[model samples]
Target: MATPPSEYAMSRTPHFQELRMASGSDNLQGCFHLLFTQQYAEIDGLINVLCEKRDDLFKKIERMEKLVEEGEGLCAFHDSGNVGLEFMKETLKTDKKVLAALTGLLDMACEGRREKRRHVSRFE
Candidate 1:
């Protein structure tokens, strides 16, 4: 029944979408229903989109770093000349592996939630 994203009235940001069903049922007069939903598959799509963006940015950064290193000639061998280069490369590698593993995890979790919600007795 719950979770994720935004645009305009809700910008495209990562956030859990909480749907409070105030009157979907008449029997629950004084109680409110709480559910989580991702309006446009936002939660399911977040990781892919985010990873793609980060991968692109990292590529651009890698290109720039390459240029800087080439310009530095022998300085590229010095640790001080390329402070975070190795770290950024490692991050790029980790992101690729992590993204592959995480791609549909949110979707699976959300489906489980939907299954549980559907089984809940409507009268309780």
Candidate 2:
């Protein structure tokens, strides 16, 4: 009977000579098992490194989202202040009252912007 395909292939390769000699087997199963185990270990290590990098990227994305939220809050605050200033100027029509309200609105807006900046800077 002709030799099995695995034996025939192994017998033709110079690399398997030592394994064949050491195992004294025609199947070469031991050589295949050792190679597979080594490859699996390498793949496991690579997967762990990839998982760590994914977690780091997730944290960075969360930080960026927080900064964007802070910026949006600041923009909304400024828009509301502008609306209030326009309304005061139209309805009051008195220079002194309008100026006083405008000054207060500006002070509040500046304080809000500064608070937002401080919050966003924490993420950086």
Candidate 3:
């Protein structure tokens, strides 16, 4: 049966020490120790890669949050600008109506003066 990882770790420590002390030879325990050491190195490398990827993901999330805030600010600015534009348009419409009324008043005054001139000339 395969040993559990925790038990294998415990068992491998003493064997690793023994393998280090012994001369390089065809020893089964030494071979197993070397294999376990290689596997542990590979696992450590994978863990480092995973940590790097996690940090990159966090940075991307922060950037997205900042972008969202900027988008909201732009939307608010545009809404206020639209409201100001509408107010200006309404003011312009009122000003046009006032100008038209003033023009009509000036025309009536000139027409009344002409009628007075004609009546005065008829009397002379």
For every candidate in turn, the CA RMSD to the true structure comes to: 12.6, 23.6, 41.9
lDDT of 2 by residue, 35-82 (tens): 445444554565556556555655655555555555555544685755
Highest TM-score against the true fold, candidate: 2
What's each prediction's TM-score? 0.32, 0.42, 0.40
Any residue pairs clashing in model 3, and if so which?
none
Residue-wise C-alpha lDDT for candidate 3, range 1-124, written one tens digit per residue:
3332355654777765455445253444454555545544554565456556545655655565555555555544785755655554565556555555555554554555455445444433
**Cα RMSD (Å) between model 2 and the true structure?**
23.6
Q: What TM-score does model 1 achieve against the real structure?
A: 0.32
Local distance difference test, each candidate: 0.47, 0.53, 0.53
Q: Against the true structure, candidate 1 has what lDDT?
A: 0.47
Candidate 3, superposed: residue stretches over 4 Å from native: 1-24, 75-124
Off by over 4 Å in 1: 1-35, 74-124
